[model samples]
Target: MANHVSSEKRARQTEVRRLRNRANMSAMKTTVKKVLEAVQKKDFSNIDALLRDAQSVIAKTRQKGSIHKNNMARRISRLNAFVNKARNAQ
Candidate 1:
């Protein structure tokens, strides 16, 4: 338990930030999954758009401090590479 008033307020703030970060992470994961699924299904038509959406979500997540900038860059890079490979294979 938080003993001091300041500690209690800090705890509350932490909880709120945790929830916000969780939501951002969830959204980022969902967008990434959507892009992967589209690729797996060989749905090239919408893959680019999905990749853009995933990149946007990921960048936003990083901006929100839910993920590190390097992590964000790596994810976007891998996703882009996968999409490119799939397109090339087609």
Candidate 2:
């Protein structure tokens, strides 16, 4: 639907970026889910590593502008809270 050459190029770039952002979001979600699962299972043996990995993914995504900085901070905060509570429970 882009009649102009520049418009067409812009559209192409937008499509590529959209796909990349979607993939990044999906990856972040998966990492968060993994951490939540660990918490739900009350399994702290490997949670530290998992939390670190999730934090890394979230930070990277935030740096890339895929997610907001505040959102990332909130997520990491909640994750750590869960991890700490779980660790202290036993």
Candidate 3:
């Protein structure tokens, strides 16, 4: 429990930030999943668009501080590699 008034306010702020981060993370995961699934299925028709969207989501999440810049770069790199491999295979 937070006894001090400032401490109580900080606790509330923490909770709000937690929830917001959770939602952003969930959304980012979903976008990444969609891109991966498309790659796995060899669906190249809209893969570029999907990849672009996923990259945007990751960038936005990083901008919001929900994820680190390096983490975002790693994910985008992996996703690009997957797409490239799939394209070559097809």
Candidate 4:
């Protein structure tokens, strides 16, 4: 209920932060999904663009403290490998 005035202000702040984080997380997830789909279909032409977008999202999320840096790095590494393998396969 946030009976305290300060608590009410904090509640509002929390809501704002939650909304921002949700949007960022959704963007990150969408970027990852696009990358994975491109990898699965072996859409080589779009891979570079998708990879860059995904990498940027991942780096931003890591910087914002939404995700661990190592986790982001691992995902980026896997995505890069997928792109590389697809290129070599062609």
- TM-score per candidate, chains pooled: 0.96, 0.89, 0.95, 0.80
When 3 and 4 are scored with TM-score, the better candidate is 3
Off by over 4 Å in 1: none
Model 3 off-target regions past 4 Å?
A: none
Write down the lDDT that model 3 would get. Answer: 0.94
The TM-score, computed over Cα atoms with residue i paired to residue i, of candidate 2 is 0.89
Best by lDDT: 1
* Model 3 steric clash total: 0
lDDT of 2 by residue, 4-89 (tens): 99999999999999999999999999998999998888888898899999999999999988989999999899989888887888
Instruction: Pick the winner on TM-score between candidates 2 and 3.
Output: 3
Give one digit per residue, the lDDT tens place, for model 4 in 1-90: 999999999999999988887888899999989988887887878788888999999899888877788988998898788778878887
lDDT score of residue 9 within candidate 1: 100
What's model 2's lDDT at 59?
A: 96
Question: Clash pairs of candidate 4?
Answer: none
lDDT of 3 by residue, 1-90 (tens): 999999999999999999999999999999999999998888889988999999999999999999989999999999899889889888
| Sort by lDDT, top down from the best | 1, 3, 2, 4
Compared with the true structure, the alpha-carbon lDDT of candidate 2 equals 0.92
What is the per-residue lDDT of model 1 for residues 2-67, given as tens digits with 9 covering 90 to 100? 999999999999999999999999999999999999989998888878999999999999999999
Clashing pairs in 2: none
Ranking by TM-score: 1, 3, 2, 4
lDDT, model 4, position 69? 84
lDDT agreement with native, every candidate = 0.95, 0.92, 0.94, 0.87
Candidate 2 positional error at 28, Å = 0.8
